[model samples]
Target: MALPTVPHLSQDGIAFSAVKNRPAYAIASVDSALLLASLLQQEGAMRVTDVAARLGVSVSTAHRLLGMLVYRDFAEQLPDRRYAAGPVLRRGPVQQASVARLREVALPHLRGLVEAVGETANVMVLAGPDVRFVATVESDQVLRVGDRTGRTLPAHLSSGGKAVLATLDDERLAAVVASLDAAVAVRLERELRTVRRRGVAVNDQETEAGLTAVGVAVPPSGGVTGAALSVAAPSARYSRDRLPVWKEALAEAAGGIARDLGDG
Candidate 1:
């Protein structure tokens, strides 16, 4: 069976596209480093031998490249000798023009959401098992959730991340959940079920001690889903009583973003 392809927001925003042709003056080592990073991000984990074979380089060369990645926090060596995506890869932007376009298109909607809900709003995209905040619009209130752009949080813990996961097909969802610890996987599965049932996800301090957020998936365009829209506030100001209003605002913003993306 084919390995499940993790979606990233790119020009197409969903399906994996082949890397562009190698440049005429391309430095081999840099190219290899980039490809290796992409491999770890998409394929979960691999041994040095696997990396060598995949990159068609000698084992020593692969090892050297892996060392560089580890230094840069893009990959980490496992106790078993396999390497997996590390901090940078998990939080990195999509590195495509479409991500910029997506951010631009979503900003107005995000601003509108902040106006409606009177809290910070964010646009997030799934990156491997993590969610990267690509854009944020902060509330004008004296005390509010601050901007989180360029930050990453565990997908199983963040409201926007859970919302994105809820949009995944079963196979894709299983692939993601399998990467987590057994205990986390069990709990995440339960939360995801609730997300599916309610058409929204909530993070009541699951990611941070003082933050609470509500999110909805930006409906997939062309059968691809990787992004979500959320409204976040300080936990002190969060209440179940506010959920109905927040959910409605999030849904509207999500829909508007989806329509804009589809039309693009």
Candidate 2:
């Protein structure tokens, strides 16, 4: 059976031509990820051959794709080497067990970051093309930014989103760029390259004027989705030259959170 092609704009707000006829432009990795996700969500645990047969791909391809899913925490390797829906997916969409766990584990570190940098600290997770702010700790300073917990913003516009984006592999990145406008794709690709080189992502008032944020991706754990720890401060107080502590704090906090998730 042929999959239906649905019209949608890419992250860069560029329209994709219908995939039904022009299959050449279709991103195989993205399609495979979607197919595998659907299978795992509906069937729970599965073996390598199961995914291979369902996606009609080679066993090696299935294994490679599944590994990526595991890296992003959308799937996990079971004791027998079979794959199962990961904690993030099993917890369901929206605020639930996994998200709650992430929030609980991250809040203390976020607070510590606030104390360290005198800026607002946040934990953000990728939700499709956006980064959702699941938890935040506000700075004590009167001039600090407002609490942004529960807010959602475009992934490319925020530090956390860019950090997560930087972790995507080439095929996945190609899929994303394919959906964006020519101009936006070029710009976002350039930025992601920079993020990869630096091991961190920065938002210099990109999401909102006068606000600056620096973020680092949290390494994947058993049940954690790709996420980032970020510190947002007023640009006046966010001087990169003087705020090296913020980078150090985010790295420490991200490491702690990843460790906790691994232990669970």
**Index of the highest-TM-score prediction:** 1
Cα lDDT of model 1 by residue, 192-224, tens digit: 999999989998877655668899988876333
Name model 2 segments beyond 4 Å from true: 1-95
lDDT of 1 at 175: 85
Candidate 2 lDDT, tens digit per residue, 1-264? 121331333433322121123244679798788667645653467899988986789999999999999999889999999998786677544434566578778888888888887778889887767777777787766555555555667788789989998998888667656767899888998999998987889988776656778999999875777688988876777676844677788889999999988887
Q: Candidate 2: minimum summed lDDT over ten consecutive residues — where?
A: 13-22
lDDT minimum window of 10 residues, candidate 1 = 13-22
For each candidate in turn, give its C-alpha RMSD to the true structure in angstroms: 14.9, 14.9
TM-score for all models, in order of appearance: 0.65, 0.63
